[model samples]
Target: MPQKATAKFIVIEGLEGAGKSSAIALVRDFIEKHTGKAPVCTREPGGTPLAEKIRDLVKVADASDPLCDESECLLLYAARAQLVARVIKPALAEGSWVLGDRHNLSSLAYQGGGRGLMPLVSAVSAATLGDFKPDLTLYLDIEPSLGLTRAANRGELDRIEQQELAFFERTRATYLSLAQQDDSIAVIDASQSMAEVHKDILAVLQTKDW
Candidate 1:
């Protein structure tokens, strides 16, 4: 019988300024170096061409007509639907590792928790995209205040970034709660020095043989 090939799907998740993008880049580089195979690095709300358009609409829309909580949740899953259909599923089918900057957990945190929408968003997302769970999820944990400070230093805030500190605190709590519920999820102290955080992340990936 032919061996069943397995492809790892890893997601780096966190709030704004939690350094998820940087972590994804580092993981992709490490995977390429070790396996000589470049992991497909992408982000939610914008991985595929269609999804990218949705991302812009979600991120740049004015706050006056604030996206309703349910609408926001639906938009996120809509982007994920496109991304999975166009990018993620195909990549995994081809035996390429998929490393996402954010995944479904992001919707759970940002939309369900931060926005105080229905808790069923997570379930809806999972049902919408069956068998799409990440093999490993690295949650960069940090205090909301610290994250906001870091984000402010970076530049102008985006729509989500402009949310109040309380919102982020709720998001963080949601992430932690999810991590506690799922064994595949790992929490990293994102407040540490960049080098140290990178090292910790690398160690986790190495242990998983990613």
Candidate 2:
């Protein structure tokens, strides 16, 4: 009998409006083509009902009471912890591949870089996830201005998305830096057309051994 496939977790990461949703679809198809198994998909700040509620809490803002940076950072991690434990780990343990729209990298980019909270974010991550990481991370790289422009066209911006341009600039810079240091992470030029970006992503999946 063939050995059971070792489930691999693939993460799609980027700044707001980086085309992550479409990328996830492409990756899902690619995984099914390669593995002959449909990968289970999930999104960060959500997956479970409880986690979704946490997602809402982090995403929506009150007019008079804005969430502090520390509170926002911690809230994001709290939602992530729930999703990882309740969904991701279990799916992987069952020999099912998992595709995450965003993972811990989002926290690193937004909370650590955007909010300048890397120290506290690191502590929270270590405590919550230890060294757990995605097997493959595809970061759709785009200029902050372009990303925000795309997001604006989509509709109302969420609390996080409504942040100033500098916030996303910091986030993008950190993504670039982190991708440079990580073998598992691949950067795609999301400024290109969807066809071009999809082509690039497929090339990475096909060519990279990982």
- Give the worst 10-residue stretch by lDDT in candidate 1: 1-10
Each prediction's TM-score against the native? 0.93, 0.96
Those runs of model 1 whose alpha carbons end farther than 4 Å from true positions after fitting are 1-4
- Candidate 2 lDDT, tens digit per residue, 1-210? 222468889999988888999999999988887777888899988888988988888899987887899998888888889999988999999988899989999998889998999999999999999999999999999999999999999999998999999999999998999899999999999999999999999998888554
Clashing pairs in 1: none
Estimate the overall C-alpha local distance difference test score of candidate 1: 0.85
Task: Rate residue 96 of model 1 by lDDT.
Answer: 86
Model 2, runs deviating above 4 Å: 1-4
In order, candidate lDDTs are: 0.85, 0.90
Colliding pairs, model 2? none
Worst 10 residues of 2 by lDDT: 1-10
